[model samples]
Target: MTVISTGVYPIDKLLNGGIEKDIITSFYGPAASGKTNIAIISSYNISRTGKKVIYIDTEGGFSFERLKQISKEDFDNVMKNILIYKPVSFLEQRKSIFLAYDYIKNNSNSIGLLVIDSISMLYRLEKGDEDVNEVNTELARQLQVFSEINRKYNIPVIVTNQVYSLLDQRDKIGIVGGDLIKYWSKCLIELKVYENGVREAILKRHRYLPEGLSIKFKIINDGIIEYKE
Candidate 1:
């Protein structure tokens, strides 16, 4: 494992000291699951610590509106070290990510973290609303590139993802593409909103932890923090 830090206590615990540098990390769950917020907060941490961060907005992942909510100091720091690239053109979004990767690689001395706000856009680029084989191939290719960047640069990579639920009357709720995802991620965390308004971060799969451990958490003020429900 490479030396990496997630800056969140519980997440750091799972990674055995945050995250290893140069590894592709993933967080997946339903909509408004707090993955994007956490990724932004994580970028803030990297910025504050005197490292450059590259945020790839594959599908317009960031907003000045959210930054406006942060404290003035944090906002200043985020602006100084962070660069956002939204590629909307002939190359497509997946290629935009690769372009950002190239930017980070060329400026390896300046980059400390690479954040792909949500990787699903990579799939959507090829499929164009059709969630079929074409989408799968592009998505897989992007993940492979993600892994390469992780190993080569030793920079921590965080990718957020949207989930598709399988309609089932049975007890289980099916999540699409996750079975393939587990192969590339070192840790997995899922966010689910319960029927009673309590959101639980289910430790569905972690490489070194128990199967069912969970934490009650919330996203507040554009930041990701933990709390007891």
Candidate 2:
């Protein structure tokens, strides 16, 4: 598939027919803004097609309950196609990414998507003790591997990032990796909680699409839908 639906109609349309193949798409946001939810739905969307989805979970964000809610009848089959890895530390995270690459390289035709939900969780934790520059460089190296996989195997990579309050800019929030993440991600979307518990996805950067395009949606139990109210 050239592109895979996020399983949310408005989001799919906003993304010009869903997340594109052979590129890295990033969804960054504050807590409870649907980043992980989108990741889960996207994995299911691809796995349902009989393709393998390599999901590297750094924040313990993968929920069996939620996957069951989304997959429903095909839960067993879809679950089998999704290979999930939960890395406890930054080093473990790097190892997991390498393992994912190896699996994809060996089973190139079967892999559909690679997701690192909250990719920066362990990075953030280690930043304080380790040299900031080294941490950033390691992050860059990890992303470079993903980029190579995209070009080599032609599978989509989706990663989630946490936000931090910008220093001296209280009202603003910036993604964890900032420019590095933006530079690597071919498509970038910012998720934000909007009025009455709805969420908005703002297209920050894309190769063809104009920036600042957005859509509003709500996260329901089964999946997400365009908000009507």
Candidate 3:
């Protein structure tokens, strides 16, 4: 299958050519670890190739200023092809995601990327009020929808997730969506802040990449770049 370039050289090299198409890839990290940056840049890169992108933003982190910084002259055109949906609540998010999936399945020839920036934000917020069984059921349904779309249309699905520290395992962290997210995702990447502005991406789980492998990168004005020693 074909791969979509993330527009970051080191990342592309790490993945052996960039993100693989028709799979669910997730990025999990604490705040300010540059998860959103990678998603935006990858979406922008895919849009640059004359294909459309469906971006579902749950945290209101989609920054036009940042996109302009990365794309410069192509920003306006790129934005045109990127269909963005900002869903405020869990119900709204689910609706938006399914709607996008339906649209893409019908217009499969035009779309190349599907992104959900922080997929678990609204789910986490609503979990307190809802029953545990209901939450898990909803999450499972959502993942099933994503998987179906990916397999049918051959479109890459990239999602960002929040992380919580594991109290017993001090060095380990768990993603918000728990095992369902872990099971559905074919590629799982974890990001950490190394310094003031530098961040590192750890390939925690991938079909090919060994666990514990890491690459250092920084979020610059033009998006993510490989960090230099």
Clashes of 2: 0
Model 1 residue 115 lDDT score: 83
Residue 74 of model 1 has an lDDT of 69
Candidate 3 differs from the real structure by a C-alpha RMSD in angstroms, to one decimal, of 1.1
TM-score of each: 0.83, 0.97, 0.97
In terms of lDDT, the poorest run of 10 residues in model 1 is: 169-178
Tens digit per residue, CA lDDT, model 1, 69-106: 65345677668888887766324667777887788778
Best by lDDT: 2
Worst 10 residues of 3 by lDDT: 7-16
Candidate 2 structure, TM-score to reference: 0.97
- Per-residue lDDT tens digits of candidate 2, residues 75-157? 99999999999999999999999999999889999998999998889999989889999999999999999999999999889
In candidate 1, stretches whose alpha carbon ends up further than 4 angstroms from where it belongs are 13-16, 88-91, 128-131, 169-176, 195-197
What shift in Å separates residue 206 of candidate 3 from its native position after superposition?
1.3
What is the C-alpha local distance difference test score of candidate 1? 0.69
lDDT of 3 by residue, 1-229 (tens): 7777888766787787888787899999999998888889998999999999999999999999999999999988999999999999999999998899889868999998899998999999989889978988998899888888888888889989999989999788899988999999988988899776888888878887788878888887877778878
Kindly report which residue pairs in candidate 3 clash with one another: none
Q: What are the C-alpha RMSDs, in order, of all predicted structures?
A: 2.9, 1.2, 1.1
